[model samples]
Target: EWLETLPQDQLKCLVDEVGKSGKATRTVKLPTGDEEECTFLPEHVTNEKKKEKQTTTTFMPGVVEPSFGIDRILFATLEHAYYARPKDTTSEDKQTRGVLAFSPNIAPYKMTILPQDQRITRDEKYVDMMRKIRQRVSALGHSCTVDDSNATLGKRYARNDELGIPFACTVDFDSLSDNCVTLRERDTMVQIRLSVDEVSTLLHDLCWGRQKWDAVLKKYGQSSQ
Candidate 1:
């Protein structure tokens, strides 16, 4: 390759000198089935074309070396991150609620919509409003699910929490009148009453990580961090 990229005279001269001094020996089998060595006698002029390529590579200009061993780097990183701590069996543990703290975008449902009363469940107005909310979330590539069961609000919230749903929207008696729903954050256990039109997009942005907790707090006039 180097000789191919070099000038004619430079390549030819380098070849001539190497052929005179460099003895190229290759493996050969002996008469007794043991191995012996042999090599073709190097001819300077006969191999002129190959010589140019070699010369260019040997004297590459403005070159920089990029080197690495991928396996070695991976091994080193693993060695540094591994921890060795002894477990204590006698310690007492408190109730953790077993929550997976993920950003909203990764949640299966950004928010759980809860109808306050059993009669409100599957009511045309509530169903149509939820469909609108789902459509809005779907358009933005977010997710939502309708839980139209006769379960209590607390039970509904618990079930969604098990599903790792990050937010809950409660359609209370107030919502039927004021067109607003109660938004509950799964992690912080915080609630903010928001209009049905406003909560869908707000939860979408929150889960997508485009908006932070501070921003949500600011929007709802809640405390920061």
Candidate 2:
């Protein structure tokens, strides 16, 4: 009866093999749900006495096995996030740049703090302001980093862009006076001016998808880069 559970072609093959060998070994489930290998003999080949001595078994039904490939998922995510920006002919440097355009939720760092110029990066006031901003952002449960290198502002932005940082806050000399910083978005390269306290809250809303960039642009207007 268990042999009848197999498909037609498989049953025919099994019958051919069993006809020659007089018996075939198969794994079957017992009444207690345990499985064991048992020798099966054809009905015609076994007498009534042999059939009475044999035990009954059942075959398991087909099942679906789900699998997850981590490596493939990572590769696909990288491919989706990666793209090359065209070279800027207007600038002195005309080299194409690679950028990882990961979403705010998926990016390793939600935002990066940048100094407008190398000079301000060394200033005590700018450093203190940057430190405070970083703290505020961290308090909101978002990951952030500061770039105080001597590299130009454009180079620093490009570096963070490659790192897939979704937002940037630039502290310039004016920030020392007004306590406001320039907030820049990665994908659209849009800049907006906002106060230090406002920036932290805005970054939180943006990262959490509570606010949209277009709505922000309409409210504050875009700042000149």
Candidate 3:
């Protein structure tokens, strides 16, 4: 009885292919506890004469969901960017320096400004300069941060590399006297000095791919890791 009351159109749709082959079996158990064999044939398929007059036609095709796994993509990206290097210390314990070599567009922050010493950052004058530099980068719609943490300058640079920061600018006592700062490439650990006024513009261009690090090396002397 339950099967008899079921929507015939939907049930027929389910077995349309089976009807064409005539090789499928369907068992129906009635409410009275008796079993019966049933053949499902949609009106369109069962009656050859009705095809010319049928108003509604449907196509059965499989569809797939299109949402790609973003988390997996991110994981793969980080894995590809993973880098390791030798330790700076003499103990011979392999100091694995892990770095994320993310493209500028994908990085969390475009650049990081660090004072060579946290002690310099404590001075009001250097703090103000760092603030202005940050403001300049922010005005260009690029994100940047200041790491005034107590970690050694080398350690801070290493930490930012792991986080995939593309560039780092260091403020030292010479920046106060010469109005310039040292810029370091995260992956290469190459250093170049540029005037504070021109640094932000250069950084914006570099991050946007308008300028390349090779140009900096050509213009300024190089420093190694």
Candidate 4:
């Protein structure tokens, strides 16, 4: 009833945010599956003074309401990013893999750290790095977990790859020695190795699609080697 009291700009921002969040609040259905209006009913007018103060005492027909579930948005992301014969896909100068491409704000982790030598190193270094990355992600209102259960680094990367984990940091023996790791973009088979401190921000940008592999490689010293 008092919604009109809200400032017009604030109302617009809210409507925009809600729309971007994939809310389908367009058509409201009645009891018989008929579309209903969102008309607001005003307080009844009793006294002559109240009636005199009122502009319209009755409820006027309103716009139709469109309401839907959050699941629809989730599915849309997966479907949009999903790829069949990924090598054949071409988008944004990158091959589309089975990525969820979720809005960065909701990823389980801004980045996932994977170690290439899972079998050779017994995944000790990779798992440890993943644990640290997971902690960092959680501290920042995100989450992460490792898939170091005797699977190939490729397999592990593929699993979380589809979960839309935007970035995966691959650690190797040299990574342990130099305190650095390689970053893999989920959508593209692009890989760039860098130091651990670089992982946090790299993850953030990848999740948001703000930074692409091409950009990361450039920032981290791209080489044709």
User: TM per model?
Assistant: 0.53, 0.68, 0.68, 0.55
Compute the lDDT for candidate 1. Answer: 0.66
lDDT leader: 2
RMSD of 3: 12.2
Shift in Å, residue 48, candidate 4:
37
Candidate 4's TM-score = 0.55
Over the full model, what C-alpha lDDT does candidate 3 score relative to the true structure? 0.83
Against the true structure, candidate 3 reaches a TM-score of 0.68
lDDT of each: 0.66, 0.86, 0.83, 0.61
lDDT of candidate 2 over 1-225, digit per residue (tens): 555466767766666767888888878777688888977688743322233566789999996755867788988998999998987778888777889999997888999999887899678888988999999999999999998898889889999999999999999888978889999999899999988989889998998899999999999999994
What tens digits encode model 3's per-residue C-alpha lDDT throughout 56-110? 8799998886677888899899899887866768766566789999998779899
- Model 2 ranges off by over 4 Å: 1-67, 90-92
For model 2, how many clashes?
Answer: 0
